[model samples]
Target: MKSTIAFLLTLTATLLSHLPTPSDAFVYPKTPISNTVWKPEQDVTISWHDDKHAPLLSSSPIFDIFLMTGADDKQKKLATIASNVDGGTTTSVKYHVPHVSPPGQIYFLMFQTKDGSGMAWATRFTITDSEGNPGTLRPVIPEGGTINPGGIGAIISSSAKHRKSSAAAAKPAAAFADRTATAAGAHAPVKAANAPAASVGGGNTQEENVVVGGASSHKESSALKASAGGLMAVAAVVVISGLQFLGF
Candidate 1:
């Protein structure tokens, strides 16, 4: 009788295992298959499938959707596509894809219940601009490099160094120009000093007046010497005439 009771309990447990459960509400994403390409600002319908055993509507009524990137382990949330969605009645949600910075090929969607009970992750896909081109990824700095906040460290450093070098090169040129100007100023006074002076009166300077005075003095001395020599000759002639008159 105990064996028969044990067999009956085992049969009941097996039957319960095959029954449907609420935990299988959303098990797989269906619309955004692998390698699907999407464009920014475009309307995208994200859909999912539930297990056959799942109920028509999930127990959780509200849901949230996110645009995610990167690997599963290091997934980065890009944006919130929808919030407070009615997940109980529908298996799909419509979202307008926003413009993502550094757009790449590794993008996916994540759907979760409001209470964080259920979740569904879609396959990885590509997000391109309206021109159908996936944007380039931002550059990554290598090891042991200087880092600047809110910017690319290596690029910023290189640009800063270039500006510094340009400034350094300009300093010597400016200094040389200043020195040239100073030397020119120093020589200006000398040039002014050597310039010919303006005549005071009658177009003759003080030097010309000195030369005229010297010529006048030399002429007066010569005239006086000639007058004395003539007087001496006349006196000699008078002396000779008196001696003849005496007839000695």
Candidate 2:
């Protein structure tokens, strides 16, 4: 009984030890995306080549290819490009990765041989640009936000001045009504008419300047986000190859 058990144990260990190692000479093209902005209409291809000198994976030599895509926060396997290959000299596989959102990575896999081997290689490519869509829109800043205090004050003063100037430029009848309304709002004893008019004029000038300042902030923020996303996509491609040899 002891001898029989030892023989079985040796057989199991031999089978485990013969597991295939991912060879280093395998090569795949840098996967290409139809667009980088990642809209629903884009298509991408992921392809790879095997070294001719590498060991034939099995008696029949076959591969099963799979594609998985990442979008909107998660990775899901895409169904349209999954298949098994059995023939000679199959150095490449093509996968069409799907995109439905703004950010995504397309990953490709080839399981070596037809016996359901655990060994496989995978690489991720990124989709960029929306199809014919101009791209991410520039956002507008809300008025009266706290970006610039002095500039904000200047804008408010400028708007007030414009309103007063328009009233002054009008005929005397409109001017008197405007001054009368200002006087009625002043709870304290009314100041000199000229002094009150100057103060009201300055306020209108300030408000106009504030509106212009709001526009600049949005352009700056969106640019920063797009630039960062591009860098991350590049890094993913470079790092993913290292993991490919690990068979994960």
lDDT scores in order: 0.40, 0.29
What tens-digit string does per-residue lDDT give for candidate 2 at 1-248?
A: 45654554555443333322334212232333223233333343344444443434333344444333321112232332433454254444443223322222232232333343322334333332223222222212236332211100011122233243222222222111221111111111122222211010100110100011011112232332343344355445544543454453
Model 1 lDDT on a 0 to 1 scale? 0.40
Q: What is the lDDT for 69 in model 1?
A: 49
Candidate 1 C-alpha RMSD relative to the actual structure: 55.7
Over 4 Å off in model 1, which ranges?
A: 1-25, 52-60, 135-248
Error of 2 at 72 (Å): 18
Off by over 4 Å in 2: 1-46, 52-60, 69-76, 87-89, 93-97, 106-112, 128-248
| Best model number under TM-score | 1
Q: Write the per-residue lDDT of candidate 1 for residues 1-248, one digit (tens) a residue.
A: 45654554455443343222235235466778655777755777777666443332455345555665432222344556666656455677676665443344455665555554455566556665444565432222124422100110010122233232222222221122211111111111011222232211110111100000000111122332343344345445554554455552
* All candidates: CA RMSD (Å): 55.7, 31.0
Provide TM-scores for the models. 0.42, 0.31
